[model samples]
Target: MFRRLKTSQIVVDVIVAVGFFVIAWPIETITVTGALGFEYRLGSLGSVLAGLVIAGLFSGALALRRLSPALALVIAWVGALAQMSLGRPPGFADVAIFGVLYATAAYGSRTVYWAGFASALVGALVITVYLTAGPMYAGGLSWQTLPLALVMLVAAAFALGLSWTIGALVRTAVRARENRDAQQRAEAETAAEQERVRIARDMHDVVAHSLAVVIAQADGARYAAAADPAVAAGALATISTTARSALADVRLLLGQLRHRQGDGPQPTIADLEELYAQVRTAGVQLRVDVDPAAQGEPPAAVQLAVYRILQEALTNALRHGAPGGAVDVRLAWLPDHVDVEVRNPVEPGAPAPARVGHGVIGMRERAQLAGGGLDATEEAAVFTVRARLPIGDPA
Candidate 1:
């Protein structure tokens, strides 16, 4: 509730209403002139004080709550009647206050807002007729006052209608702003969730692929220790290298998760050679046909995306491709674009692996983030994964 009203606005409203009543009460008293057949006097302290109190209360009530239109009209009628009976003579000035109040309340959708306007108009007409009753009986009713009364009524109605329209417009604008803010907040949350999922996929690819290679090498090392000590030592060396690379990858991923700005080294297209070496050590025969032009330069983000895509593809191949089968990796740098392909031959009767795993999804996401395209297909003993990245602008 406090959020809805400004302190200064509330203060201003209170002061204006109180001040108007204070000034209007004395004016109403001064209107009590002689020979009007009304027992009103501006010099009467008690009557002036009483009128001031009444007017103050009336003004304050109008500002307080959601006043009904009917109640407002009744108050208007009563005030008009009092002003006519107690003031000097019946005139537009006597009932103008009630008309203004009625219009405000009616436009505000208060209970007595419209009613107040209607009642004030009616009361004004009644007072006019009452003042001219004796003369009309002696002669005839005059039509001169009709135009003035009609003008007042029209003005009041117009003011009320315009204010109500403005209020409705303001409400609509406020609601639209609120809806837009809510939509923005929801979109931000969804983007954050998607980032989280992408990070999780990266972790899965890094850990699973590294551990799988380590496990295979350990097994080979244990088996060849007696027969081929040199081969066992080589396997141990591969294990150590795999473990260190895995640790570095983990640290980079954690830095990304923590939102650390430029905290870790990012892999680029050059890192693909090292990645190929790791896969080769894992017992996958990797045949590479990389473009010399694609060896050195790319945008940092694009480079990272390319590296991740290749990593995921290689990890998937090692997990599902036939043991000892050759995995072919092709990188071609066109004048305007870069193309990457990873394909492995599948053994006969091997079931297709899960398609929605983290590795596959992560590759797809990375390609998309880099403003590239990727396709995975399995047919006739061959599994192919291809990505095409536009080099026109860095991601």
Candidate 2:
């Protein structure tokens, strides 16, 4: 695919090209009279036609410097050859060579980038030989001429090498910046994805668990309304309270999803009491065993994970366990970690469900996020979910 050109850079290059043409419209050439002696000469202003053709080619290269640096380099060579052929001296127009070489290294593709380095080395040698050729023709070079030739070669090499090196450095810096930008974008995307999954899991736990209790209470209230009005009324109250709480929790989750502000504290281990009360109110016998910790409470991440996992497991028990069946919940807080286990008897008549439900998946994800592991299984008519979350562990 063709990359778009930078209009501003093209404009600047054109302006610079115009400046070179204005300064060197009539080109000149250098000539040496003696080989060994220090007798040098400069050619008179060359023919206007030769100057126009040579300078125009170099200016064209300058204009195309950033637009197509490889082509610009070719044009530069063509201009250099034309000046040598026309016996013209280097002039202000040759100034475009520095910009063209820099662009080739900074903007060109890999092949052209290396070609720029080749041009720097070979062009220096060509300049050194061409400038001294006249002196050699007049009087063959001797030991006296060696130092002058060496100086010319070293000077040419230094100027050209410096320009290419600066451009190469720019290329490296640009690539590094691009890599950093790409990495930041990827990290941001990953964080957003994780946030989405968390919201979905929380929503599922709240809605599914709350609705299951509301349904169980509603059914029981309908059957008991004739036998005991007070019992039916209490069931209705529980339903109302459960529904309001669920609505509030759902709203809280929604608020978190909608905006960054108003993010309240999440449920922790302490909230398990309210959860158990709700399960009992739904006509399920919940037996909870708590093994307190000597190391105080765990990290917030661990508490949140424990609460959510237990909530989900009990929610499953309420939804799929034997009608009025008993559930056993255990929590043991150790120095380094907290362990959670929930066990409920299954109804013999109830069909086997998919081994892992969405609730179970959400529980597993919560445990893993808190730097923990979870296992949920059904064996011998009993469903169990166990989790071990590390305290203050890096996630």
Candidate 3:
């Protein structure tokens, strides 16, 4: 509840209320000297009591700052009338203080104008009572005081309007700041979610491809050992190498979960030839056409993206294509872009496979991250995967 009141406004209200009471007490004594027909000292005591009552009224109004403006205005007006009726020379201070309180409640709402109207009416009434009654009871009422009361009413109206304008501006500034902060927080969360999806895709590509190669080589070694010792030994050696390499790759990927900064080695486009050799050793006939003149060195992220795409495409071919069928790998390096294509003959009876698995999704995501694209298609008896990476464009 306290959070609603601005600290400066609270302090100002308290100070103003106390100041008015201090000033009004002494002035009341002088105004009532001849009219009350009492000793000046006794009149001064009465004035002090009146000042205390008015102070209580103003303090009560300030305490209700967060309440409805209409309710607070009604309370303040009642207190102002009471003070005017009891005091020796009724003053406009009560109305002026209430006007300021009403203005404060007007911020960011239409309550200010209504409160101002009510305060002005009450202020005019208090002034009229002071002018007619004080001197009339003493048999010497004057006309000069009417103009003074009118002047005070005009000044009160101006103060109320000015304060309301300032309060409205302050409320607008606060709301704008809150909206800007909310937008920044939302953007940060969106960027974090995208990074998480990218990491999941990379993990799927690495694990799926490595395990497929190891399984194919192990099966070849088991079948060939009885027929030819030399071929069986070669197959076993290739299986061992494939398993070790896969283990290392898994370790590298898992390290990313531990630390984001320099936790393991990063593979790039230069590793593509070694990748082809492994698939060839697993008994698939692999053909490679890579241009040496192509931009040999690309940005680190682009290099990693290209390596992952090729890895996923080759793995899919080895797992799904005909045994010992030709898997063609093509790389065309242009002045402004590089294109990679992998195509393999589809095995019989598996046309329109059940689903394109995570491998294809990973390849597509990597291509997108590098400001490129991937397309996979099946035409006639062949399945093809193609990716294009732009050199200078970073999306």
lDDT of each: 0.66, 0.82, 0.68
Whichever of 1 and 3 has more lDDT, that candidate is: 3
Per-residue lDDT tens digits for candidate 1, residues 1-395, read 11245667667656766666666666544444334344435557755665664565456544432333344444545555554454434432333344345334423443344444454455545654654442322333458655654665566556544554454465467669999999999999997787778668778878977887888788889999999999999999999999998898888888887883443676777778888888887778999897746644666767778788888888878778898889998888776678988899877777654364556667877888778888888888888988988775645
| Top candidate, metric lDDT | 2
- Alpha-carbon deviation at 306 in model 1, angstroms: 2.4
Best by TM-score: 2
Worst 10 residues of 2 by lDDT: 29-38
Kindly indicate the candidate among 1 and 3 with the higher TM-score. 3
True-vs-predicted CA distance for residue 200, candidate 2, Å: 1.4
lDDT of 2 by residue, 1-395 (tens): 12258778668878988988877674433343453443445445436666678779989998887888889999999999887776555667788898889988888899889999999999999877777665324444558777888898999999998899999999999999999999999999998787878888989989988998999899999999999999999999999999999999999988888885544878987888999999999999999998874267677878778888888898889888988679999888887778899999898767543264688888888988988889988888888899988889755
TM-score of each: 0.69, 0.90, 0.71
- Error (Å) of candidate 3 at residue 217 is 2.2
Q: Model 3 — TM-score against the truth?
A: 0.71
lDDT per residue as tens, model 3, 61-148: 5545443345555666767777656643444345445444544444314555455555555555555555444433443344855575
Error of 2 at 205 (Å): 1.4
